[model samples]
Target: MSVSTPSSRPSASSSASPSVADLVAATPADRNRVVDLLRGAAILVVCLGHWLMAGVHVDGAGELRRTGLLGIATWTHPLTWVLQVMPVFFLVGGYANAISWRGARARGTTYGGWLRARLRRLTIPLLPLMLFWAAVAPLASALGVDGGTLRIASMASLVPTWFLAVYLLVVALTPLTLALWERCGWWSVLGGAAVAGLVDLVSVGGDLLAVGFCNYLFVWGTVHQLGYAWRDGALPGAAHRLGLAAVGLVGLLLLVGVGPYGVSMVGVGGHGVDNSYPARVTLLFLGLLQAGVVTALEPALARFAARPRVWAATVLVNARIMTVYLWHLTALGIVVGLSLALGGVGLHLQPGTGTWWATRPLWFAVLAATTALLVTLLGRLEQPAPDPRPAPPAVLPVAALLATCAGLAVMADLGIADADGTVNAWLPWVPLVAAVALGTVRLPAVRRRGDRSAPGGYLAP
Candidate 1:
């Protein structure tokens, strides 16, 4: 959830960007290169996992269709144990946010200023994505795309938005949560996990489906809390890490093996009780297990990430992590759409067939190329613009945060298009709310004396 930029050594010529070697050399000595590598790795894994799981084909009726491979190949459910990397993502977010918040506090930055900066970094990248889908939904609908196809495309392309919605909520609560961490240390994490367990019990046992949504906060919040422990070095030594792993493994076994939760960490259609959709206690356990495993390997990971070539690649990828994440699925959709338009060329091969598996390399090559193109064109938008103005009244950012979260949550659920592909009723408000969030702390542009350009301009915060 934290978007980080790599530090660049100043070039001999100011206009020239720093080379990869320069970036690696300029890395702060104390910076945890392993965290950066893990974040980049997690994003790549999520993209690959999604691409691999997608089962797209042109039906016998000549209509495009999509299905989840996990749903078709039930045995693949356990594979999600490795593929579902959201826990790592949240853990890194907590680590990064704690450092950011602490630094901002030390620098005399007010809560409003700090919050606004974080919100801008998070929300600005979303505008272009929202705009593209907003324009495409209605037009595609008019061009005779069926509701089912459009829905599939919308859902796939907007997957990142759903994650953003939940992550933004967690981030907005960081001040309070981090404070709890400081005051109570490990208890904060336990309290969050306990609350998540309680929510699961109430929702599943009492059968009140609406209450389960609370786990979105409790479960991820607990994982995020773990990141704070990681940053503070509270989880030290092999014993601590291995103990966490054991407890998590036991919890997952109990929850999924002996309890009612499904084994799949990612949603598999028609699978009873998805552990991911509402984020059951199973996910918290999975997060703990993954966290323990990854942190235990930190010494080795740090050594690997310290290599000049590897660290440079990590820095480059981390620089555009948000853009890459937001658009990778869209790139997949485009690749699938192209295949469908071309008489289903490579996609006609049945899922799980020998030929289908054989062509994965070609399929992934096309996806990687398409995703690279998207990142080249759209990645700059993810960079935060320089804004020297003072933070606005706290109310402005507070309102903006609420509005932004609401808009994204609605979009994640209903999507920009309804079943028939027309723009959803909530679509119009998405951009408007985004504008408000981006504009909350932005000041009117001022031109220097003798400047002939426009006197005022708008910039993303």
Candidate 2:
């Protein structure tokens, strides 16, 4: 790994809760600034991307209908290419997981324990967001909101939550995946790619929708494996990174230009095939293309992030990542609701019109400000919970994580409510995930103490 370990940085709530400035100051000098830079930029791009693209209008009876710029303006494909950042997040996550897991194992942590600690952080932040949605459904339904819009808005708001489900599955399988990487090296990635191609072929040729879903593993799993390569210096040199970027660019162009792939990185729902969903080869190309872009930009971004002011901003953004993501859709909803109530001129126009273009800057500014406020108000919930005074039982962490994943997967399909839009489906996940996250102790830390004599820190080369 290029990154050298530094002294432990304090938590956001070490003494009193950290201010954004304090959080920035607390970052260790030896940590990977470039990774954090990429993270910060990616999060903002995602937030603003949705806000800028979202076109909401009232139905005749008055409920917000969501639309996107890609459907409206065919010229927006290049922009989607620039902003689709999920691949970068997964790659960085792979790298980060490699480092952290090695660190934990060095101190002799068990796979189960390490898995528990990892999944807890991911799941805890979700409860509040889901709970808020759960609470709102009945009230909104009672107020006579259009059933279709209510359903669409609720599901749309939680769209980002699918990443958590996917990520948790990845993290849960990390020990196994890492082991596969150890034994097979880059062959694992190649295998995944092959599987992905086969999936596309089978799904497309056979007219089987279920088979396409397997791309989640074949595509992202391959990219995640690349993170292992990245951490171990297997992906060495600017030439390597640039070559990847170049090839990925060509591959993406071929997929979109020649293949049946949709041009947009994000899929507009209710369309026959949302490119982002159901895992297409196009997204795999996106991963390749974006990974190359990330590598190409890393050096410059690292240098820029080293600036004290820039670093501080990055820290602030990083601190509330899940919080920001969770709240961003709500921010859009609020802004759209307000704009409609006020009868804002720009928002009322067709999305691609010249007047809409002129009004975007102001609209963006308004959305950003509103999102910041929402983050400020709820972001703290995402901060790591105070070190548990008395840790919970060591057993069942993985099981809990699985239940959580299942719940989230279900939620992704059904939204906060069932297909009928009843919040009753909130079972097994909301309560189950909450109980595990809150009730569980610090699994890794607790495990590390008992087995300090082992010599198993970093994974074998």
- Report per-prediction Cα RMSD to one decimal: 4.2, 5.4
Best-matching candidate per TM-score: 1
Candidate 1 structure quality by residue, lDDT tens digits, 1-461: 12223333333443233434544555667778778899999999998998888887777787777767888889989989999999999998899889888877877888888777777677666767777777777777788878788888877787777788789889878889999999999999889989999999999899888899999999999999999999998998879998898889999998887898888999875766788878898999999999999999999999999887798889778767888898898898888778777777887777877888899888889999999998888765554444556866767677777777787777767766777556674563654565665565343354232221111101111
In model 1, where do residues sit more than 4 Å from their true spots?
1-13, 16-22, 425-432, 436-461
Q: Give the lowest summed-lDDT range of ten residues in model 2.
A: 452-461
Clashing pairs in 1: none
What's the lDDT of the predicted structure labeled candidate 1?
A: 0.78
Q: Give all candidates' CA lDDT scores.
A: 0.78, 0.68
Per-residue accuracy of model 2 over 114-195 as CA lDDT, tens digit each: 7656655666567676667666776777776556655666666767777777777787677778888989997887788788
For residue 424, what is the lDDT in candidate 1?
Answer: 77
RMSD of 1: 4.2
Best by lDDT: 1
